[model samples]
Target: MTINSAHRFEPGATVVRRDIFGDRVWTAAPRRVIEDRGDTLTLAHWPGVEGLAPTTYIDSLGMDSPAARDAARDQGFADLASGAWELGSWRWRDTTVLSRFQAGEHFSVHLFFGAGHRPLHWYINFELPFRRTALGIDTRDLLLDLLVEPDLSAHTWKDEDEYAQGRRLGIIDDALHAQVELARERALELLAERQETFPTSWLNWQPATDWPLPELPSFNGV
Candidate 1:
């Protein structure tokens, strides 16, 4: 699940990601480049990450110090409470409102994350906020809303072959099929929330203008 994009980076900014060891590593390019410098090594030591010792500050660059995190938290909290954030029927990242060039849409600053502007094929307004908030630092709420927490006893497949396998394995009966379907229905509710149509939204969008567009076959009282 590795993804690389031509990401915009700020000079002194750093980001951390969880590694295989369950330890946070400085994944930003500038930070890594500084780490390889000999003098920087002597200035700070990489304390082997383990239980109870989750974070190690970069004393050399005065980065990720407790003070720095606190400052960031303060700024974030201030932004969250600011009156500049507008309340609307649906929340959207401010950039998305502007970028989409919406004709009748509304927005609030609170709803927008700079990284969450990609459009999806489905229309679910409730889920739209979730998608827009997903790439931010705190995404638990969005993830939970989008995920269909599976019922362990429910049948996972509708096909006879799959049902038979479950029966043979002494798993739940095919009656569990309804439970799976119920889960699926909830998932669809999430999808219908965003009301945009594919390849047709205002953002860099163009309608299919080819004349004599294919007409649908009539159902003719079938």
Candidate 2:
């Protein structure tokens, strides 16, 4: 799908992964656009909300801890005396951590970094071809994904049960299933040959400290 003329991102533009209701569930750290080559957009990582931590979800806090009460208040919950705190029992922290690489359309590749900025794994996400929308470039995650090691020596298919469940539930139509299968085949072929499309340099690549952090786009529906 073509990028919406009004929302085309240029190099250095900031973009966030579009989430429903601007939820901070998975994506909280925005990515700096490095290049916008129409069909492909390159993004560089920024420090996540957890700073440089390896994981995004913090362990749950105890229900009666002062920290938990403070966190509930900070998150806009009613006072502890009101007994309306949903997280009054526990708090699972969300963060914007890890490095990633995403290309639009067909098959989008994602690379994740571990602690100390070490290369972790590659995630191949099969999705609907991205389309530029009023809500930024939009694509639907197909649920089927392939996970690969940093050196491409080991790999595993992920979320097969989810994908099958989607199919059984009629959420994934035959056409979408075929498209995801094709993308998976192509990804396997690319990995078998050690193609340069996989950014091996990112294993050691670091963003310049002076670069500004990425900002989220406006969320007004058009």
Candidate 3:
């Protein structure tokens, strides 16, 4: 069941942060990726490099499905933002959480549907820091072949018309609200489970719709 009842978010930038070990972890991952003929002209995930494949990452999303493979092809090469995927033919969920604490960069967890829109691939992304040690096997990377291939973002809204742009922008705001509510609920649950998890990471989530681009540096970074 897609949380259709939740407010629809305007497509744009959203800033969310969670505290980790007294350090404030801000999300700096880019939300947009422009690709032209296999060449990403803007915001390269693996910047300063050309056509470099993903060598040390994993895709939690199952890539075995033909449809998933096709979608991956369309996305080009960018870090898998988060966990976004469809479950069977009726459910779809994808989330990307970029943390400077985890890897001094970004990491994601995605879950999506396959050919029939059913649960075909459900996974995560672990953008580990350069010098961080690998602990347990992260399932996010194993599903999407992230190690061998770099992930890419989508520039679908670049040429959108004014009305379409407005709509897209609106989605981003809605998404922020949804994220906040979701996070709050989860945080509470976690707190109940263990008080040690207190002082849960808190972030000032503000979508692009609220203010000018410059005012929100969190959204502008990544």
Candidate 4:
């Protein structure tokens, strides 16, 4: 799909970091568009959902323990009654995510924070390019990911088993697998060389209390 210039976000626009499925909604407080340089967008995360309620009690309870199953069922009903099925009440610590989508490249550098908003590690997600729809832009997360320390002193791969499982299930094709691998390698190189793939200034940033909270759009399917 052609990238629509009109659909590009502007700085200060309230946006969300959400997955294709409406189930996993993050940034409930609505991440502000700190930088919207056409091809890239930097978002400053605010307090948001800490955890999402389980969809199925059966799935949540691995072995079908009767007590656990009953508890999960009750919780599910309570969540539905309270209308908390869509968004949880858990708050997020300080965090920031820088997204880039140029040509066919799609990735995000997520920075986690500790106490006092101290810089923590970076979680890099490589994924498919975003497709903008009427509701919002949507992208699917690939199985592979990378982890880098705050100092950029070391880096490691993450979710290798999941990636391999996707390949085995024919979900991740050869081309996509190679693409993700290359993306991981590129991330390692950047970290090793101390390259600034995303703005470091956002590491210490926080959102204003008056910033609007994000609401999930109606998901009719993509």
> Against the unseen true structure, what C-alpha lDDT does each candidate score?
0.23, 0.55, 0.25, 0.59
**Which ranges of candidate 2 are over 4 A from the true structure?**
1-7, 19-29, 46-104
Best prediction by lDDT: 4
Tens-place lDDT per residue, model 3, 1-222, is 122212221233222221111121222122222211111111112111111122211132456676766455334222222222211111113322112222222233223223333332322232221221111111111111121111112112111232233234342245443543453354334334643221122122112233322111222211
Which segments of candidate 4 are over 4 A away from where they belong? 1-3, 16-18, 21-30, 49-103
lDDT assessment of candidate 4: 0.59
lDDT per residue for candidate 4 within 91-185, as digits (tens), equals 44345344444435656777776666677788888777665544445566776788877767777888786677667655577997887878777
Q: Once model 1 is optimally superposed onto the true structure by TM-score, how far is the C-alpha of residue 57 displaced, in angstroms?
A: 22
Tell me, by TM-score, which candidate is best.
4
Against the true structure, candidate 2 reaches a TM-score of 0.66
In order of TM-score, best first, we have 4, 2, 3, 1
Residues forming the 10-long window of minimal summed lDDT in candidate 3: 133-142
Candidate 1 at residue 8, lDDT? Answer: 27
Between the candidate structures 1 and 4, which one is better when assessed by TM-score? 4
Per-candidate TM equals 0.17, 0.66, 0.20, 0.69
